[model samples]
Target chain A: MITLETIRTAHDRIRAHIHRTPILTNQTINELSGVHIFFKPENFQKIGAFKARGGLNAILQLSEQERYHGRTMGPVTTHSSGNHAQAVAFAARQVGIKAYIVMPRTAPQVKKDAVKGYGAEIIECEPTLEAREAGVREVIERTGAVLVHPFDDDRVIAGQATAAKELIEDADYDSFFDAILAPVGGGGLLSGTALSTHYLSPRTKVFAGEPEGAADAVLSFKSGKVEKAPYINSLADGLLTSLSERTLGYIREHVTDILTVSDAEISAAMRLVWERMKIVIEPSSAVPLAALFKNKAQFTGQKVGIILTGGNTDLGKLPF
Target chain B: MITLETIRTAHDRIRAHIHRTPILTNQTINELSGVHIFFKPENFQKIGAFKARGGLNAILQLSEQERYHGRTMGPVTTHSSGNHAQAVAFAARQVGIKAYIVMPRTAPQVKKDAVKGYGAEIIECEPTLEAREAGVREVIERTGAVLVHPFDDDRVIAGQATAAKELIEDADYDSFFDAILAPVGGGGLLSGTALSTHYLSPRTKVFAGEPEGAADAVLSFKSGKVEKAPYINSLADGLLTSLSERTLGYIREHVTDILTVSDAEISAAMRLVWERMKIVIEPSSAVPLAALFKNKAQFTGQKVGIILTGGNTDLGKLPF
Candidate 1:
């Protein structure tokens, strides 16, 4: 069972590798939303996302146990085409281990370059789930490398929980937040947030913001089971993945509610942060604030905490 | 005389109004540049620029003496088509006084709207310095409003000095930087930075960065008088203005050297900051870094301090 202690242990394991990203607030945002908002900006995190924490925690544990497929030292493998891939690559390099990333051939050249820049090997596969899985299996079969599941594993969930833990610990003067929000993709971040908020600030309500175009988490939250979205197209490319059994179980028990916003709202919120706060944040990072703006009456006068997920965006393809 | 004490007093005065902008350092940027760089990001300041400090300090003095142009409470005025207009407007509103901003009629509606959003009245003039001066004179004569010169005034210079004052005071572990750099436009920020570095970190060398297309300050520094650029067309719009006699005097006395960089260099440096630091800095803010990169031989391995001046940019028009 992943308890508060497990999250604490994970944070301790990855403390040196990850950035202690600052909690940022702008007064203009407060006045506009009729709520005080604290943003935990993981856009400044290593690998430019919160995935760094999970990736580091998992890889470091692999090194610590000396149980690397019964070898003295071994390589690790993961199948991701986004921040997760970069995170695994960056973390593997940190521990002097090799990382083999199985990425879709359809992925952007920039994404592939980022992984390669971190000194990781890339295995190209067709842009299909079956092909990706087969590619990962081939790497594991050939090299006896451990597969670091992106969000489905207990270690990854525990690592993601530390962001919320830090927010609750860093809240104003011993006062807990009234609510905490995180955007739900595969539910790793949201479940981790729920666990931390439930353990640390028990009174605080936990909410997940999901993209309406890729609204699987909301449907799954209602159905009490993992489900796929009816459609999967959104500018928030980071929040397009489906939930796993482990993450869904945590969400069913702990999360208060899940809200959905459109791509337009996400873009507006992203632009506002860029204009007012003078920081570069990805569209997925803006989903929580979009939800807050969409439902201001419920959160009036309340202090809300949001995890701004990442800042890796193609400069040439800006939304606004 | 604008001594270090004057700057210290200005900081204390505007401390409540402006943000004590944080100093940021990225290890990746350090490794890439081969210099330990500390960035004082005034892009996060009130009104999204360091102009807030000088504007507030100047206007706050008007409130302190109950001496508003020999009246109980009189309006304040300034003529600017840039951040200075917003700064004066914001500061006037802070003290519960009226502000009349004389701006070029051809100025962007967004800039005009920002001043209006802060509750300042706008007086539009033709796109000529003479017309701007005339508009300010008309407002002053009609309403007994005192003029707040953008950078040439002692009070404004003293206020601008506080950015470097904070940087020097916030340096790592009782030590100061080996060198400091600021971009020179009208020379408000550069002269002020030089003063602060000269007073607080006497061993530190002060340098100014100028856009090659609008290279006035460099000529002014060598000529020992205010000089105009041979031509003015650059992506660094904030730095197209020429220096004043007062600013030139300070630069000649305190600034060690003035280096110039092309528009291409400025754009490259700006993109790097946005990518690596995840901060939205305008083209002018990148000039100092561009200068550093252009002349890395002199600053290799030295701990360098840079003032990231502002973050106001037109989203529709990006250099990169």
Candidate 2:
């Protein structure tokens, strides 16, 4: 469970290691959504995503006994085909540790190259959830490396909370934003965001945007239990994972609601941000804005904050 | 004709109306090019380009007699199919005036839409330069709108000079950059940049990048007169214009050298900025960076500044 002190402590631990990414605003974006929107762009973060925060926090906290084998790090490991892979790899190199990233053979080349570029040893596995976990387990058994779960960890959740903490601190003068939104994938960002909002600014409500193709979080929110999505097909490729019990518990308590948007809506919003804001954001980063525009009545004339998650997108495969 | 005082006065005249856009740096870019690079990102400026500075400066300086035919502004006219058209249109809107933009019929739709979105009346003509000039002259004859030449006039050059002025002021403290680069089209930005560097950071050498496909500026730089390119073709659509007599005069006096790059090199460098820096930049903006990388030995171990011109790219037609 994350308390206010937990996030503050995590921020202090990782503040020097990661970027306190800037909050950007645009008049055209505000007029279109009918809200005074403040965008917390994590796309410009280390490794080009907010994952850098949680990854560094998790790694930096390793015990002297647990982290070191003489001079070199005992090695940390993670199985991811996403920004988290690059995050772990980059964080390890920053603190003089070795990282072993287990990615599926079918995973994107851009992500793979980025992880390797950060000097992480990549172990390619079969493109299946079981294969990925097995690969991580194999690496742990052989190399005596610690497994750093991508989302379902107390340390990572606490670390992710710092993004919202920074956002609230920067955007507030007298009162906080009227509402705040973040995309829900494995629910790590949403849960962390919710906890930070509930602790730092009680009046502000927390909401999440999930892709219609990956509707597990929305179902879990309604059913009061972790649930699998009915289907999986979306341009927002980063939000395709199921939520954990740890993440769902926090979401059910602090989050107001979960909204889903179609791929058409997501791509449209993404293009607008690129064309109007002149910032490169991936499809997943557009989900919250898409939800806001789809249901604009709820936030008309109010100050709303949306976390733009990352910018690690493959430009070769853009959906106009 | 454009002195340091002229640029300073222009900056004062249009500071409130324009965004003093940010200067961004990326570690990967610096390492690859082996030079400490400071990027003046005018891509995030109003109208999504640096053209906004000159356009606003020109429009804001319109006289009480020349600018007023009754109540509404007498209207401003320009013949451009690129970012300049949108700049004039956006600047006109800011000052509560009408803008008549004469654009070639073959101009990209994305640019035409942006100009129209800013309340400019678009007058389309044949794709030839003569036809475009006739269209602008016709607009002047009918509505009496003052002609704001894209880059030929001294006022426009002085306005464009502010981008480099701000770049030098922000990036230098004890010593100036070793060299600075800007893409040369009609030479407005390059000539203005040379003048500002000459006045403020006299130690900094002024260089320019031009596409070999549209390689008129290099010839003009050597010939001491405006000369046309052998052929007109490039992915950097914004840098296809030939230099004017006024721009050529300034270039001969202050500019150090002009470098030409192939379209392939420009597109590759453009992708690198988009991928590594996570910022949206058009093909023309990447020319200077491309030239820097192509001739890296000259800039090794030195601090260099490059002005990233704009970000008005069409997502549907991105190369690559």
Candidate 3:
């Protein structure tokens, strides 16, 4: 079970390897929202996402006995077409271990190139959840590599919580935030953020922001059980995954509420950040801001903290 | 006359009003160039440019006697269609003074709207230098307002110098930088930067980065006299202006050399910043990086400082 202490330990483990990303604030955004908003820009984090922390923490926690059975050690394996692929590759390389990534054939060339840049071997599979799982299994069977589930693992969840731990402790705000918001992408960031805020600032409520098109977290929260969307289609590509049982348990226990925002709202918020803050943020990162903007009354005259999940964007295919 | 002391005073005066912009570094970029690079991102400033410092300093420096002749105080007038217009407007509003901006009708609507949003009245003119001057003269005649020249004024130069002052002091480097680079337009930023480096770190050299299409500053530096470009056409719209006499004097004395980069190089640098640093910067702001990349031999193992002049970009009209 992951607790506040586990998160703290993970924070200590990954402190030296990751960057302490800046807390950005904009006067215009503050005025418009009628609230003091502090943004934890993880876009500036190493590997261009908060995934770096989790990946590094998980890799470092692996015991030598578990890594190697005989004189030879096995490679780490994962199935991802996004930032996690690069993160795992980077973490494995840092720990002197080879990484084997299973990616969909339909994934963008940029994503493939980024994972390859981190010195990871890629194995392409059909664009389906079962196909990805089969590809990972095949790689593990051939190379005896261990599979690192993206957001479902306890170690990864604890590591992801460090971002919020830093946000709560490092941000130069008075006392604590009234509310902390994070995008719900397979419930890694939101669950981690909820746990951190629960431990660090008990008075602060944790909120989950999900794209309306892929509102699996919202449905699960309302239904009081693990739920999946029938059809997922959002510009926020990072947020299309359904929450795992482990992540859903944390969300049910800690998250105050789940908010949903449209793709248009997401794009508008992204544009505002680009224009006003002069920082590049992916569509997924903008969901929290869009949620806050849409539901302004709940946070009026309050202090809010937002986690900007990542900045790995395809410039040639900008939505704006 | 502008001096280091004047720049220090400007820094003190505008310290609270403007952002103490952060210095960013990228490991990939450092490895690529074989130099430690510090980027002072003024694109994240109040008016999205370093002009905010100059405009605010100039307005705040104006005495009541100079501002008010009879019972009525005169408005601040300037002829600009870019960041300066917004800067003057924002600064005037902050100081509780009226601003009269004479902009060419051919200027982008977005630029005009931004000035108006800052509570400045816009006076439209024909798309010519002579027409712009006439429009400003007319505004001065009608309101008896003080003319705030964008770059020629000593106060503006002093204010612009504060950016370099903060860069030299705030950046996390062991010793002083080997060189400081800034894009030269009317030579306001370059001159100010040169003066600041000259006073703070005497060992550091100041270099001006200019677009080859608008290579007047390079010609002027080489010829040891003020020179003008026969024609100006560059993607960096902020770099089309020629250096004024007041700015030219500082450049001739303090600047080590002037380097020119092509428009393609500027775009590449801008794209790199967007991809690597996750920061938005204008084409002109990218000129310094392009120049440094081209002239890498001069700064192979040295520390370098680059000023990102502005981030006010039109999303719909992206060059990429």
Candidate 4:
């Protein structure tokens, strides 16, 4: 279980380095959905996603020797095709280190260029889990670099929790929310949010929203175990991670429900937010909103808070 | 000419009512353009545009007679097909008045829906300047509504000046910017920015960026006079106004240049911002960026500020 003290320490460490992203109130979405909607807009954060929180925390938590000796000359390895790769690269650059990102060859050029722009090296591989692991290992061995897992790590989970901590402190408004929805992937963010909300605002129910194409978290929550997703086909690249053991355990204890949204619903909700609220959010960010809209019976007239986890979609090639 | 004191008073009048939108830095654009780019992200402003500033200021400056005598119960009229229509509608709602928006029948459904969502009455007109004026007059006669000119009024210009005022106040980092670039329509925001910047930071140059297709301001600047737009042809709907006499006079005295960009450049800049910065901005917001990028030699290594005027694009049918 994560402690408030650890999360609070992480918050302090990354405070100056990361953006205290705004929690925007959407009157339009509220009127449209009939639920009081508060969006924790992480898109405004540095590196354009909430992944900055975790990466910054992990990098700052390293020992002096690790910071000086490991990062100075060699590279840091990460396997991601989304915001995490950019976050790690950004964090590494801030810490005076190079990053070696292992991405599939078919990854968006936008993401690839972003990683390169941060002075990071890239090693593109086949679009398979096995190839990704192999590419990461090769970079780790060749460069003698540190491996920063996107999620499935304690520090990363603690870092992701800080977003929730800020929300509870700044946006919870002293009113006990009926529910708080967070999208779950490898479960780092959701688990961290669950732990923080359970400890700080136990009266508010914590729910994990997932895409139907990436419903490992839902299955894991139902069976009281960790579930492995052999492959993910959702447009939401962020929520494709299977449940990590630590994250799953925390979710089992703290989260109230695990709901799923279809790809079509996510796309529709993404369009609704862009058309109505005028905010550019990726499909993954719309999962929680989609869940709220699809399961309106559960959240009717409820003070529901949602983490719009990311907005990193390339507008030129939006799925919509 | 507008004064700093008037702008400050406008700020105070709507201090709690409006959002002090965040300033976003674009690394991708900075790298590409070789100039440090700072975006005054009014895209995040209430009503999803900086028009909120002018609308709120205009309403707040209304005389007591306007507020009482049940005149406030009647609708407020504005001739606009863009952010101003929504801004006036939102401001009217805040002041407990109905808004009668006169928009072209060819206005985007998204903008129409925005006005409708604010509880405003929409009066559609033929897509012509003469037809629009006639439609607005008809609505005004029918409802006895107050006319909130989008950008031509003194109150609107004073209100729009606050964006530059806030930017100058928010960061006084000891380095004077070479110039401040903003799009010009009726020149409310551009002229107001020039006034405030001239008074506050005399050394900083203020430039009006307009689309080549709607270069009335450019022609006005060249001729040292106000000029009417030949016809509405730019994709940037918010930058399609004829230069007002007051605005043209102010720009003639204070603004250093009036630059123009092609429609393709505007669209490209819009796409770049949406992809790299992960912020949704309308075509009008990208005009200055387009101007800066298209004419890079003019701003090389110079600290530049661009007002990202709004984020009202419909994601379902983005022009790209």
For lDDT, the strongest prediction is 1
TM match of model 3 to true structure: 0.97
Instruction: Write one digit per residue (lDDT tens) for candidate 1, span B20-124.
Output: 898999988898899999999999999999999889889998788776456576899999999999999999999999999999999999899999999999999
Global lDDT for candidate 4? 0.84
**How would you encode candidate 1's per-residue C-alpha lDDT over A19-101 as one tens digit per residue?**
89889999989999999999999999988899998888888887888865665668999999899999999999999999999
What pairs collide in candidate 4? none
Q: For all candidates listed, what's the TM-score of chain B alone?
A: 0.97, 0.96, 0.96, 0.93
TM-score to native of every candidate shown: 0.98, 0.97, 0.97, 0.90
What is the lDDT ranking, best to worst? 1, 2, 3, 4
**Per-candidate local distance difference test:** 0.92, 0.91, 0.90, 0.84
Which residues of candidate 2, in runs, are more than 4 Å off?
A: A63-73, B63-73, B172-174
Give the residue spans of candidate 4 off by over 4 A.
A62-75, A140-145, A172-178, A228-231, A300-302, B1-5, B67-75, B140-146, B173-178, B228-232, B300-302
Once fitted onto the true fold, the runs of candidate 1 whose alpha carbons sit more than 4 angstroms away are A67-71, A173-175, B67-71, B173-175
lDDT of 3 at B100: 96
lDDT of 2 by residue, B1-320 (tens): 66778899999999998898878999999999899999999998988899999998888877444546555557899999898999899889988899999999998888888898999999999999899999999999999999998899888888899999999889747347999999999999988899999999998999999999999999988888779999999999989999998889888998899999998999999999999888999999999999999999999999999999999988888887
Model 2 DockQ (Cα-based): 0.87
Candidate 3 CAPRI-style tier: high
* Residue B144 displacement (Å), model 2: 1.4
Error of 2 at A260 (Å): 0.3
Q: Residue A43 in model 2: shift from native, Å? A: 0.8
Q: Candidate 2, residues A1-320: lDDT per residue as tens digits?
A: 68899899889989987878888999999988889999999999989888998898888877444545554458999999998999899888887889999999999888888899999999999999999999999999999998888899988989888999999999756356989999999988898999999998888989999999999999999999999999999999889999999999999999999999999999999999998998889999999999999999999999988999999899999988
